[model samples]
Target chain A: MDLFAERGYAEVTVAEIAERAGLTKRTFFNHFTDKREVLFAGAKDFEDSVAKHLAEADDDLEPIEAALLALTEAGLALAQYGDYARARQELIASSTELRERNLIKMASLAVSIAEALVRRGVPPGRASLTAQAAVAVFTDAYAAWTERGATADFWNLMQQSLADLRRAVDAAPSRPSGA
Target chain B: MDLFAERGYAEVTVAEIAERAGLTKRTFFNHFTDKREVLFAGAKDFEDSVAKHLAEADDDLEPIEAALLALTEAGLALAQYGDYARARQELIASSTELRERNLIKMASLAVSIAEALVRRGVPPGRASLTAQAAVAVFTDAYAAWTERGATADFWNLMQQSLADLRRAVDAAPSRPSGA
Candidate 1:
């Protein structure tokens, strides 16, 4: 990330990154298949942990509640990497390809969470809608948190965003008088 | 779309499309910069119509409700193109590049709706969160409608999805007894 910040993502090469990190090219390849993966190496773990946490929520917990629990768990897991995450986001925002990759990554996480919810006995449609909504809110909140230089606790931001989501829904136009 | 369905998207050329449409290549270029643009030609109109309706919705309507009205209006505007829409979706699904383009397009629409909501006096945070959640549900509902061969009215699907979104939020774990 430091190299990416100094030299720009497009200008950097894997060999240089490996050398800068004091690791051999072979060792670097052993970890990430490509240079871009270096920045996203933790994403797979993030998805898995969130799914696990969501599935462990009480059986009676609603889909959205389970999703929030999962997101809070994952946010805590990622809290220590705030600076790194912020820098990585900057690098991604610099390139269209990176942005596409990041979008796909987040989409996959939403799908995984939905599937996890389904496995916990939520109806497929409800699970999917809840998961997508939760992920959308969580992603927005995370961005807001990072934009604030990560001073706010990620869980707090997630909860606030969740409330905002509910408030928005609650504000939907009321039904007209019966037909 | 027929050409794409018959020969596959990557196998078709702009010249062939122009010729099949009884238009000169120059005329085709005047309308669309590329073959992909032909499939997405209405997207700008979609954004404009939705924004217009959203801004016109009752001032008291919440950000999400306004967005829903806009979406329903836009969906109605595009309702006549069900077969074409489904075909275009199939073509897009066949290619990673197309899928990425579609995702970016949807993201931009969400951003535009959020901006419109802000212009209508919604706070920035609420506007963006509402816009995103609305888009997520709308996209899923549209997909479901298309999957069912468009037998269900798009507006109905939107309403059902909105209700599901509300249910999901309502089910969110109640705040623990006292903070």
Candidate 2:
């Protein structure tokens, strides 16, 4: 990441990265397909953990609660990644292509979660909606935790985000009364 | 979109589109920057319309409400696109590069909405959160509306989505006591 931050993602060469870490190019390839994978390396593991939680959840739990349980549990673990997480975030934020890729990754995750919900007998539309909304709350809360230096538990921060959204909606200025 | 979808986004060459439509490639260039733009022709216009709405919204409205108002208005206007919308969506769905571009376009729009909130004195972090949450809600609701043969009002569907999220979060399964 230091190498990336210093040299920019586009300018940094794979060979340079390999040599900088005292590794052969073959060794680097054994670990990652490309530089982008360095920042996204954990996404697959994260997704699997979330999926496992979702699968193990009580079948009767509300879809949102079940998904939130999975996400909060997953987020709690991810929160431990700490500065490494933020640096990855910084790298993503610095590049347009990465930013786009990041959103697609999130979109793809939401789809996977939604598919899991659907397979669990959740209604198709509701599953989709809950999946997207869950991702939204999780991402927002995760950003909060990262930017604020981990002052709060991940689940608690998620609660605050849900709380904030409620406040925003309820406090919405009155629409036309007679419309 | 019909021409592109009938073929594939990449397979349908620009010259073929112009020739089949009895126009010169020059005319196509005059409109779209490239093939993908044909799929996203309305997105820029939609964003501009939303920006206009935000600019006109009551200055005292909360950022979330202001964003909803703008997006709701745009969504209604977008409902007019109909089957062209379906074909365009299918084309983008079929192409990874196009999908990434679309997500970036959506992210750019969210940033624009966030900027409007920032200008209205919303805290930068809060503005970003609100904007992201709003986009999530909007995207979900739009998906709901478009999944079937939707021909009615758009704002109403948005209102339904807002209600759904509020209910889901507020009714979230309570945490186990003393956990």
Candidate 3:
């Protein structure tokens, strides 16, 4: 991240990155398929952890509750890497390729969460809706967190964002009037 | 659309596409920046239309309602090209490049809608949350509409999906009980 931030993502090579970290090229390749993976490799583990958390959530919890719990926990874990997260966001914003990859990663995360909800016995349609909305909340909170330089408590931001979402939905008619 | 469906998107070239349409390569280039643009050129128009509809929506409508009204109207217009839309979706699904493009397009549409909401006196945060949720509802409805071979009324599907979103959010606790 430091190397990419300093030299720009495109200019930085995997060998330089490996040398910076005092690792062999083979060792770096062992961990990441390529330079891009250095930024996004955590996404797969995050997805797995979210699913695992949801699976272990109390049976009585609502689908959104379970999903949010998992996300909030995962988000808090990410919060520990504030500087790295900010740098990662910058790197993603700097490159179209990285931005698209980040988008796909977030989309896949939502799908994984939705499938987890389905496995928890929620209907597919409802699960998808819940998962998408939950992910939106997470995304909104994350933006706020990063924009504040990651100083805010991620959990509180998640709560506030969820409340805002509820208000946003409630403010609108369930069906358009006279429809 | 037929050309793409018969031959893969990558396999089909601009020259062939122009020839199939009885147009010169120059004329095709005049309209599209590249072959991928052929599949996505309407997105810009669609985004503009959604913003226009939101801008013109009745003042009494909530942010979500305004956004949804815009999406439903634009979606209904696309419903006329059901077969084309299905083929477009399949072509996108078949290729990573197209899928990524589609993802970026949808994300941009959401951003456009959020900007429209902001113009209508919504706070930026609330506007973003509403826009993202509304887009999610639109996506769910579009998937269902396409899955059923587009035989369903797009407007009805939009309404049903919005209602499902409401129920899914309602089913979840506003905040976790112990939090």
Candidate 4:
């Protein structure tokens, strides 16, 4: 994270990242395909954890509720990496490629959440919307937490963001034409 | 679209795309930077149209309502190209690069919507959430519309999707644990 921050992500080579970690280049290659992969290494784990939580959620929970429970769990899990996440956010903001990768990762997580909802017996359309809405709430909470720094509790942010999403949706206006 | 659908986005060349359009390679270059850019040529226009509609929405409308209006307009505009959209969707579904581009485009539109909301005097956090929720509705509606083809009215799908989102949010349960 320091290497990417001090030097631009584009300017930082794999050798340098490996050197900074006191690992041999060959060892680094064994772990990650590229320097960019290092920053995103936790993405799959995060997605899986959220999916697992959703899958294990109570049967009585609504699909969105189950997804939110997963999100809260994911937020708590990510709290330990607040500094790293914020640093990575700076790098992602600076690089279009990294931003695309991050968005794609989030999009993939939404699909996973939707699939999990389907497994929980949600109809496809409802599953999809609930998943997308859940992901949206998670993204906003994560962003707010990162922006506010480590002092903020991610779980609180996640909960509050979900509540805010509910209020926003509830307050939504009917179509202008009233059709 | 045919070239991409048949041969894959990675395999298709700009020359082939140009030839398919009955135009010279030079003419294609004059219009688009590359084959990928051709697929996303309308993205900016879509963003602008949505932002414009949102900005022009009635002052009495809620932020989410304003966003829905813009989405309604955008959906109506996109409905005219259902065949082209679905074909492009298939090509995008098959390719990581195209999918990333599509997600990035949607993400960019989200930012544009939030900015428009802010310009209309909404607070930043509210603007961001409203924008994301609106996009979630649009995405679900678009997917349903594409699947149902021309048989479904885009407006109705969008309305139904927003209603579904509201219900999903309203049904969201509180965090599972006190933590």
Model 2 alpha-carbon miss at residue B69, Å:
2.6
Error of 3 at A171 (Å): 3.8
Candidate number with the higher TM-score (1 or 2): 1
Each model's C-alpha lDDT? 0.81, 0.76, 0.85, 0.82
Per-residue lDDT tens digits for candidate 3, residues A26-47, read 9999988766778887899899
Off by over 4 Å in 2: A13-35, A58-61, A119-121, A150-152, A171-179, B10-38, B59-63, B121-126, B144-150, B176-179
What are the chain A TM-scores for all the models, listed individually?
A: 0.85, 0.84, 0.84, 0.85
Docking class of 3: medium
Error of 3 at B173 (Å): 4.0
Which candidate number would show the highest DockQ if scored against the true structure?
A: 4
Instruction: Output the lDDT of residue A85, model 2.
Output: 82
Best by lDDT: 3
Question: Comparing candidate 1 with candidate 3, which one achieves the higher DockQ?
Answer: 3
- In order of appearance, the predictions have TM-scores of 0.83, 0.79, 0.87, 0.88
Rank the candidate models, highest lDDT first: 3, 4, 1, 2
Second chain TM-score, each model: 0.85, 0.81, 0.85, 0.86
lDDT of 4 at A133: 85
Model 1, range A1-179, lDDT digits (tens) per residue? Answer: 77878989889888889999899889999988776778788889999999988877878777887788788777776768889888877789898667766777788788899999989988988888888888887887888888888888676677788888888777644542111
Output the TM-score of candidate 2.
0.79
Candidate 4 Cα outliers beyond 4 Å, as residue runs: A13-35, A172-179, B14-35, B172-178
Clashing pairs in 1: none
TM-score, structure 1 vs. true:
0.83
lDDT (tens digit, per residue) of candidate 1 on B1-179 = 78888989889888889999998889999988766677777888899989988887888776787788788777776668888888878888897667766877788799999999999988988888889888987898889887888888666677788888888778634453111
Q: Native contacts recovered, in order, as a fraction for each?
A: 0.54, 0.36, 0.60, 0.72
Q: Which run of 10 residues does model 2 chain A get worst, by summed lDDT?
A: A170-179
